[model samples]
Target: MSGFERSETDEFARGARALVIYPELPGRASVGPEARLAESEGLALAIGLNVIRKKHYRVRSPRAVTLLGGGQVEEIAEMGRDLEADLLIVDASLTAIQQRNLEERTGLKTIDRTGLILEIFGERAATAEGRLQVELAHLDYQAGRLVRSWTHLERQRGGFGFLGGPGETQIEADRRMIRDRMARLRRELEEVKRTRSLHRARRKRAPWPVIALVGYTNAGKSTLFNRLTRATVLAEDMLFATLDPTMRQITLPGVEKAILSDTVGFVSDLPMQLIAAFRATLEEVISADIIVHVRDISHPESDAQREDVLHILRDLGVLDDEQAGNQPRMVEIWNKLDLLDDDRRTELSGMAARDDNILMISAETGEGIDAFKAHLTALIAKGNDLRTVKLRTDNGAALAWLHGRGVVSRQYVDGDIVSVDVSLSRQLWGQFEKQFENQIERANA
Candidate 1:
């Protein structure tokens, strides 16, 4: 609250100012009450809003007009008036009437948790796919707030956006257009899903293994991935910084190649609608041979972020029963080690050394990065096909194809009997057989 310390008494400043309100469950303080509220406030701050103030009031009854006390509404209104704040940021969804009444009393714009999140998503979406998803979500969230818009629409009554028509109040028409666009976005996304599936099929037939980097937003997954693969991804200090999955083919130290996929970071309480909408884009993580759960070792909420990522993995059906049952190859990359003091960095280093599957590294400064890369190389070596196959000299075309398309182990030749041994996938072997049919038949003949 004290950072930068800007005053909001002026209208120009107040427009950017927000008042965050979180509901305190009655008589129960064991739910880490302060932490939850602080997390909510943190989300508001991350959404690029100026949180001028925040407060928590007890929720006494479901039908209560005021939050807690009889005159609590007016009290809050007076607070708003004093602060000159134009926006009330509620940490829970409000009924349309509730929102309108709150706005009427406070003389300020009122938005709830859903609306604030939707606004953030709307602003952060960059790609066509991302924009479509965000627009659909905004429409869905707006549909529930129709009552608040009805009066505004009656006065204006013009269909400015895609929601309503000329003759109808914008409220009714907005809902209709939302439904229509939601349907269209679904169709387009389905086409995208099919295309993604096709691309996945092609990758599956190839010999390279895939490694997907996933974690909470701003957990340094993209930064780490960029350093590892020498590919640039938009690394930012904001939520949902990278919404699209970016895959790059990278070669590790042992001459092993793998596709590195950097996916959108998972967040706590991510909307279900959004998960369903962008699940196709997350297929890279879902199907990876190995998942690297990157964590911000420097962050205070690192443990909580890890929990969120794990919960999302469970929800996405990525870490299924088999993964839970065994010590799967999923690794935890404890990133941002540079942010830690010497004592903390040493402690994390000790932990990482004790566990083969956990690595502590500073992805930004390349500290301990070589060791991390070596560990990845080891994982890929253990996970991939290291078996060597020797082809006969009679299969000359196949030999040429292997040299052209594969990582060869060794090659030897005698008259009419050259042989090449290489490490490749079973699928690649099938393709190799297909490529050498005539030579194989001739050798048999």
Candidate 2:
């Protein structure tokens, strides 16, 4: 095996170096080349690769063989050799043929954007379900590159006179193996999805509403989750820092208790394979009663990042312009206020004040947290009903159910009957009525 084969396991070793490149094609003016290059470098760093050199090339037209001009390829190859880079990271999608050709010409291991993201996900996945999802996605991505991986098996082999002329090729055998693994992974993932559905059903039977945190990658979602729940998650300034979804019970101002779920962050050009594989995980966002979109207001590309997040949400059916009234309510959390200047902070505060669904706060400084909590409490209360009911003293289960599912204000015992004042959401009230119909003598809402 040459360096290209060893590069897979040794490229991220202590002394190994990598060269990063971003191909800026014509008519791609939404995001600048510098920003793309920086993001690519960040992706490389997330995997512990030592990025030695970063470059951007303006390509008029992409070549099918190498995806870059001959001169550009040669120049990049020369730079990689000069820097002693063990691998090249390309911030663009490449076909298997293009990747093989590039590696052959440059004598370096090469990876594209999708492959890079998949590697990050593979490295950061901590839970069993997360690992399964990552493996499924990796298999899906690798299934398409079998043609380049097993070219040696393309030649026919001599066999017995009556036996087959070419048995199964290496490519076919590998593809079959990948397909079998993918099938098993899909079955496991389906079971995981079913388990999640049961969990969600249990939560529904309870009274607490679920609030999910969603935003662009590294946009302070984990910070806000930690601030609200006071539980430390990996809140770092890195892309895809939180891959597995985490749920914690939090108390709102007047709401008593609510479940807060911190989920994986979104990014521009997210791989479709990840989306398909992690659909079970992202279902949390779709099932949440309220979706809180946390934004890093200090970043220069905040608006663009917000659009990307919204686009992913729309694709997931969590946000729909046509049926906006039917979907779950959304709140915009302008986080990282501490990073801004005094004047900009004041301006944002004024803007948030004018919108009922927006809150400007700093999770790090605990600024405006009380107000955000109060707003969230009020939003949750909007769907609840204050009611008074009477139950028999012997029905302790009914009383405990009410206390667990709702906020009980006053209670009085008279003879064998108990009078209770409580607040419950419409759904909980319906459940209560169904479960305690005979025990209740009178009810008023």
For each candidate, what is the lDDT?
0.69, 0.82
- How close is every model to the real structure, measured as TM-score? 0.78, 0.86
Candidate 2 stretches with Cα past 4 Å from truth are: 1-11, 149-166, 321-328, 387-403, 407-423, 433-444
lDDT of 1 by residue, 1-445 (tens): 0010111121233237788887664654333546557666766766566878888877777444434354667777899989987678777657777777777877887777666666566556667777766665655655566763434333333433445446876456756755665677678878888988898888876656788998988889889888988887888777667876788988666444678998888776676666766688887788887888899988777787777788788778887656642337688889988789989887878877887788888889998888877787666556335444445656656766665445555566666665555555556656866776555423210
> In candidate 2, what are the lDDT values of residues 1-445, reduced to their tens digit?
1101122333357435888999887776456777778888888888888889999998999999999999999998999888888988888888899888888888888889898888888888889889889888877887888755433222321210122236866666667666766888899999999999999999886657899999988888998899999999999999889999999999876456789999999877888899889889999999998889999998877777878888788888888866442343888889998899989888888987887888888888999799888877666766679899998989999988887667666789999999998888888888999988988989987
- Over all chains combined, what TM-score does candidate 1 have? 0.78
Give the number of the best model, judged by TM-score: 2
Relative to the unseen true structure, what is the C-alpha lDDT of residue 90 in candidate 2, on a scale of 0 to 100? 86
Candidate 2: the clashing residue pairs are: none
TM-score of 2: 0.86
What does the lDDT come to for candidate 1? 0.69
